[model samples]
Target chain A: MSTFIQTLHLAWQNTNSLLCVGLDPEPTKFPGALANRSDAIFDFCRKIVDATAPFACAFKPQIAYFAAHRAEDQLEQLIAHIHLKHPALPVILDAKRGDIGSTAEQYAREAFERYRADAVTVNPYMGFDSLEPYLEHKDKGVIVLCRTSNPGGSDLQFLDVGGRPLYQTVAQRAAEKWNTNGQLGLVVGATFPKEIELVRSLVGDMPLLIPGIGAQGGDVEATVRAGRTAAGTGMLINSSRAIIYAGNGDDYADAAALAAQKTRDGINAYR
Target chain B: MSTFIQTLHLAWQNTNSLLCVGLDPEPTKFPGALANRSDAIFDFCRKIVDATAPFACAFKPQIAYFAAHRAEDQLEQLIAHIHLKHPALPVILDAKRGDIGSTAEQYAREAFERYRADAVTVNPYMGFDSLEPYLEHKDKGVIVLCRTSNPGGSDLQFLDVGGRPLYQTVAQRAAEKWNTNGQLGLVVGATFPKEIELVRSLVGDMPLLIPGIGAQGGDVEATVRAGRTAAGTGMLINSSRAIIYAGNGDDYADAAALAAQKTRDGINAYR
Candidate 1:
């Protein structure tokens, strides 16, 4: 099995895109036409995938979106569909799961074996042992949440430990110790440019799953400047609501494709 | 719509037990009789629930266990069964979920609406906003992860922020600012008695879901002594593998009951 990072790089090269389409299908936000379907979420997501596939380096389905609606079957089907139709695109299951050893193993199984996610985002609050379970799956990727793209992200992440911010320590730790299988990645929100630069320098060329690009108001230019490695690779700039919900009418799929293409071009121009 | 704490207190008073039996069914560990059965995980959990219901103040089914086996339907059945048979006991879904606002809302829905869990564990790494979505569910409990029970827990948790450890900061923040709905709780491991004492004092009478008792080798006396409030009524000692996997025979459920009873009595003696 190819490493998750290698698979992601292949997808990036094939699509010429850094844009990762976040497949978070909130039922209330769906296009009006799909309101009455038995499997509306899955049907809606299939259209989004069909429209946006060519422009995405990766597809991220925030598990909460599926789990919330008790629509995990849809999520499973979406992942399988993405794999079958767009094999080059890596899927990141954005479920920030963190726990002790035994339980962590189960979560690892959920992401890798059950959903077949190429990568899964995890919280590092429980320390290395919690992360070890995820890391044990050598071929799959473990994207550790560093500095998230949210207002409250700073509450705990920006704490000064020793002389550096906690997120910096997290970045340094992930690169040095936790990358044993060469399957580790960092999640730094595009909203914080300086932190992105700080983290980019720490992890070298390891992939950065950079959210906050679209819906969360992260600047594409600054994100491209700060997050990319010297080799001009290593970022998955994700856009969820902005691209997927661009049109709330029956032409939503076409709108999603156009939005994805625009975002992909925006990142490319900056690069 | 009684607050989760009040509901927990009522159950604690009625059951006269502080023991929370963790219903994490690993398929590989199942006894011979149920090994080949299609619905083995659910069947195994049902018997365990029947045997141990009398000794528990709460039942915590770790979501990873069910997700790993793709036996979520069983998990759903188990939770529904627990609610139907033991209506007074709150089911705490041990899914250490952490995400940003909109996504957090979906996770909140998953835990409360879908699973109908009374309480759920959440990681505090992403800060207050990540937690707010869970808190919005007024009557449900928000148990934040603090001073976890793993060897690597101290790696990030003990990092000093200004004058206090990060976990202490987390505890202080959760108690003072985040507990607005009066539905907040803390998870301090039984393995860390001093940390338990530290957290218990900080949170006052807020309940503590203390794991690490049985398979993790936490001391019952130390846990009860350090974790109890002045009223001696603020701790739920959890034991998963040690109790559930006690005897690998036809009497596995009986063994689980015996282990749970012993753990309960041990906690009682300390109280």
Candidate 2:
């Protein structure tokens, strides 16, 4: 009967880990032994999930990677596998979906109903009503894109709005107006430590899903220092490419586990 | 071979219709005769497409209505059907996708490689890099969301960036920098005539996809007047529910054709 946030926090405490491993398996990067397999992406991700489950707080699977290969049903199976095997571990579907009303409802169903993701990432471009349908599902988490972890993050996000950056405005609104259901979280890139600190102050206890840590060249110490709340429990630092492809050998799963353990310890060192 | 814009202009000239029919078929709202059939959505949209082909410059299929039923294969079939029957008419998949870098490439593949949509709508919240991958495919159209047609369009879109609204800034940037591939368009809601006029002036010759007519209460005259360029060929006025559900009986396809023709003529009167 625990809420989504409560469940996430419980698992966070249980694992004592803030690391959320991203399950992105590029077929070309798969181990040579798995190249001939029909369901290579699924098999690759399942191994990553199994290897990193004990050391991770959450799992995130980017939908585009699966949908690109017409493997959406495999994504469904992956989510089901995680829930059945590691019920405490939440799966955040990295689908930055945004649309108006009924269209938003279908995206909601795609994330929560079809894949049963405990949380889903969403884009906030179309404003409140685009996300209002997802917010209605109180038991699920809706992580709104605030300041993305990309090279072009400054293009539109830095636009001045009322003497504050646009990301701050979005964070303020998510804290004050959009979290009536308490199922809201904000995404702030780990590369922008100062912005992450500012959002941390504005959003109080609402969790921030921090990307851009490993392959994206975000400093782990700065991320952990700036992103944590007063209670030291508000950030889910994600590392995908670095952990998943830590070693492209037969012991890839073991290498991923080692990388996850190192990342977990690294975050805890700063915390 | 014509470019995406050139193909769109060719179709616009051939039909003399700026009208884009949205093939969004909801099962519960389907005409009773076809509701019991398993492939009802594809069947419904095929008939609508067949009936309205003569009056439409483009066909838009909303992804939500298709994904809601786990009938993505049906959507694929519908797109294939449109390509086979009416190769001249472009199919714009109304999947408002936005993500960052590598993930964005996968989404681009989902729209272009998987679904074979000539154009795909994208949200611009993640800034330039999120839409950059889609822009890489020179032959495909990347329609960014601007001033949307929803009730909450003003929530974040109206924020003052410098002296102008945020949507204006977005339009300015998209016009100046984001059209590098020559396959760029903007989505401006028909409900806001003044905004449409402002965006048209800002973006110059870039086409605008105008949603929010008919069921959304947008006036056809104002949309045609404000959304057109000097050449009177820069607008694609879309009507979904009002035209598609014009009847609930066996004659629904004929009724849809009539509604589409009326809408087309109404837009032409102002053009």
Q: What interface RMSD do all candidates show, one decimal each?
A: 0.8, 0.9
Instruction: Give the 10-residue window scoring lowest on summed lDDT in candidate 2 chain A.
Output: A1-10
Model 1: how far residue A130 lies from native, Å: 1.1
Deviation from native of the Cα of residue B82 in model 1, angstroms: 1.3
Error of 2 at A58 (Å): 0.5
* Per-residue lDDT over A1-271 for candidate 1, one digit per residue giving the tens place of the 0 to 100 score: 3388899888877789998999889888887789988799999999999899988899999998888777888989999999999988889999999999988998999999999999999999999999998888888999999999999999999989999899999999999987888898899998999889999989889899999988789889999999987657789999999999999999999999999999999999978
Question: In candidate 1, what fraction of native interface contacts survive?
Answer: 0.96
* Chain A TM-score compared with the true chain A, each model in order: 0.98, 0.98
Q: Clashing pairs in model 2?
A: none
TM-score of chain B of each: 0.98, 0.98
* Candidate that scores best on TM-score: 2
- Give me the displacement of residue A92 in model 2, in angstroms: 0.7
- Residue B218, model 1: lDDT of 90
Over the true interface residues, superposed, what is the Cα RMSD of model 1? 0.8
- Report the Cα lDDT for candidate 1: 0.90
- B185-204, model 2: which lDDT tens digit per residue? 99999989999999998999
